[model samples]
Target: MNFEYSFEKISCKDVENFEKIRNVTLPYDYKQFLLLNNGGKPIKRRFQSKDGKITSSLMMYFPISESVEISLDEKYKIYSIGKIVPSNFLPIGIDPADSLICLSVSGNDIGKVYFCDMDYFEEDNELKKEFISLISNSFTEFTGSLYIPE
Candidate 1:
């Protein structure tokens, strides 16, 4: 079962909902802390849907969580800018059915296995190229060196 994943557009309004989920799921305050430290910049380069709703958001921040080294057994590889950073301020989301129920996860290192309720994205080569073109300054090939189970 090979599943493909693509990025999606996220808006400022989506940030508010994401914040609510983060506050509840995370042990410590992630939203406020991220704002103070990294100015809370959202990764809007890659997007799937164009409904002005962010189906997913990948944020970059200073390494705060314990760093996990990539090894032979590692499954995912996340190549961040500059250095190998661990972001404790992770991506959180509000369950569409139950807004009260918030699901959050942190420390999604490279070669990590994730089993969750994320809507699988179909890969569009053209769209991906467009996104890469848009963010020429921050483009890094996801070298398929690691076997990421689809």
Candidate 2:
């Protein structure tokens, strides 16, 4: 499977469009994050098959800063320096913050979306693939976000 992703900023105008999907998938906290960072440029990537049918997707977000010093502080780490939005959250009309958005568009159907610290790469990678497979095979939609508190 080819995993290609990007990030884009979410604008205030995009809120309702985002909410359309958010209502079905994301929780309140995720919505808050989107609203707070809509002003900045958020990364966005498109995932589709060779035939052009997008089966799955992923989004990553970055923070905004008025000054270099303020942006580079420790607080950046606490928030989604990497705003990772799941495929289930896609077709999202919101403009994301200005940051790097890593995305993947796959042929397999997506089930659940998980958000973990970047450090959990190995586990997230393995699980992401597995979740894709599960959704493809069963056509089941896994709801909710799995937050591993830092």
Candidate 3:
């Protein structure tokens, strides 16, 4: 089954340009998602951490748009002068508490999915595992794990 989302479309060129500017490669599952749907609300909104310590809904995926609000660049400001989002992480979506769901784009953890607990976001400029929990090894696993909470 495919993940169901609704949004305007962006071409592979858009993803390519963004990837080039960031000098990073998006995970196959996520890259495909961006190409196909751009981004919107997921059919199954709720998900839990692998350790089961966190459960939240996926409000939306950051679409590749010029709009300041929903653009991937706006949420992350990938190369902006003043940004607090962790290095090597892309803010993909958000949970109710405003915590970000991120994808690791580079280094050994590349392609990993994480639950970025914002309460711990300001404590360190660098991402710390204690606060950022590994939700899945890959974006595919991450989406597969999403479920609608009763």
Candidate 4:
């Protein structure tokens, strides 16, 4: 697959700092990927939705730095997932539809990736209202799921 957008490689120190600030351990596979490429857009971004009929596409991979900014941005207060996202649900990417591709850094679902639908929060839906769905068991699994579109 090709990448249309990407950030510079990050150092282990950057990852360490991020973990310390977020107070969560970064998933091994994701950490390695950050070291290789801080962030980038995936070429073949389509993935089957939970319903099986619809497909989703990732727009851009948010860099670790950008993720931090987004989390702290006051403009996104309404979109905050609060505890629903788990304190460690670090956003790694975004979908054109405003959904977030997040990594569960802490909790029973640690290391798992999820599609966090921002629209749910915008509508003030209940936390348990199925606003989030599992994307992959791990970062590696998620990457493996990606493919070049024919």
Candidate 5:
């Protein structure tokens, strides 16, 4: 739950502004994380499936700079447009391969983290639950799951 390289610290007000503009209620733990580190490179960057049969490495957590100033790629809104990312889900980070690391913002799955593989779809093009892999049941768990790859 630590980042060796992180953006400038942000206040709770900044997080509130972000949520208001984005129209989504962020998880409390995630909001606290934002206040600690807006975004950055994690110390432990890898995580794996339950059986360790599948593994993925994180690139960076997307900054909460939408309320400030940043590029489209750095902002979560760009990926959420046109429902490309799916409703009630937001891009919070990315894997090394540029796939999305998402967070659920509504329903019973609120605060849960998921992986959206960019190269999974063949046709249909619509994002579905089957295509999204549940990484953890909460943002705290997701951050806690990060580990150093062997």
Candidate 6:
């Protein structure tokens, strides 16, 4: 695993403010992580792709502000709720191929992380419905899945 962290840890106040502005409650496990370190690259970066055939690694994990920024920026173009990705799914990280790793914030799947294929969604309109795939049940589980490759 090769962890490359870049931001300082955020304070509880920052988290609270972020929550208020975003209007979404972050999962407990991920909230704890944000307090420890705002955002960066994870060490055990690889995960199963949405197709279940290939593997992928996280490109970057957005800080709270960055997450909000990207979510809003891409909302209409790529991640609009009930369009490409789900409404409550906020992008947390990206893959080498620019696919998104999202956290479900509002729906029944809240707290679960997902691997989303943006390319597939953009390329095939009919496939948009199947763009997202589950990665882990929680942030802790996602971190625990990281491993150093030989």
In terms of TM-score, which candidate is stronger, 3 or 5? 3
By TM-score, is 3 or 4 better? 3
Number of clashes in model 1?
A: 7
In the order shown, the candidates' Cα RMSDs to the true structure are: 17.4, 14.8, 2.5, 3.4, 2.6, 3.6
* CA deviation > 4 Å runs, candidate 6: 49-51, 65-84, 123-127
- Model 1 stretches astray by more than 4 angstroms: 1-16, 20-24, 39-150
Range of the 10 consecutive residues with the lowest summed lDDT in candidate 2: 137-146
Winner by TM-score = 3
Which digits, one per residue and each the tens of the lDDT, describe model 2 over residues 1-150? 111322244554455553353343334443445555532322233322223232333342332233432221122232222233343323222112222212222224332232222333342332233222221211111112111223
lDDT for each candidate structure = 0.24, 0.29, 0.79, 0.69, 0.76, 0.70
lDDT of 5 by residue, 82-116 (tens): 46677778788878787888888888889988888
Weakest 10 consecutive residues of candidate 5 by summed lDDT: 66-75
Any idea what lDDT model 6 has? Answer: 0.70
Off by over 4 Å in 4: 49-54, 66-84, 123-129
Question: What is candidate 1's lDDT per residue for 29-108, written digit by digit as tens?
Answer: 43333333322223231222223233322222221222223210111122111112122212221123211101123433
Which candidate wins on lDDT?
Answer: 3
Weakest lDDT window of 10 consecutive positions for candidate 1 = 133-142
What tens digits encode model 6's per-residue C-alpha lDDT throughout 1-150? 245764656689988886776687889888888778666777777777434665678877877554455433344235533455676787777888988888887778889888877777654343354666888888788878866566
Runs in model 2 lying further than 4 Å from the true structure: 1-13, 21-25, 39-59, 62-150
Task: Provide the TM-score for each candidate, comma-separated.
Answer: 0.18, 0.24, 0.87, 0.80, 0.86, 0.79
lDDT of candidate model 2 versus the reference = 0.29
- Give the alpha carbon lDDT tens digit for every residue of 1-150 in model 4: 467867766799988987776566888998888888777787778765445543578777767565445432221233334454445577777788877777777878888887877666643343443767887889888887876656
Sort order, lDDT high to low: 3, 5, 6, 4, 2, 1
* Clashing pairs for predicted structure model 3, backbone only: none
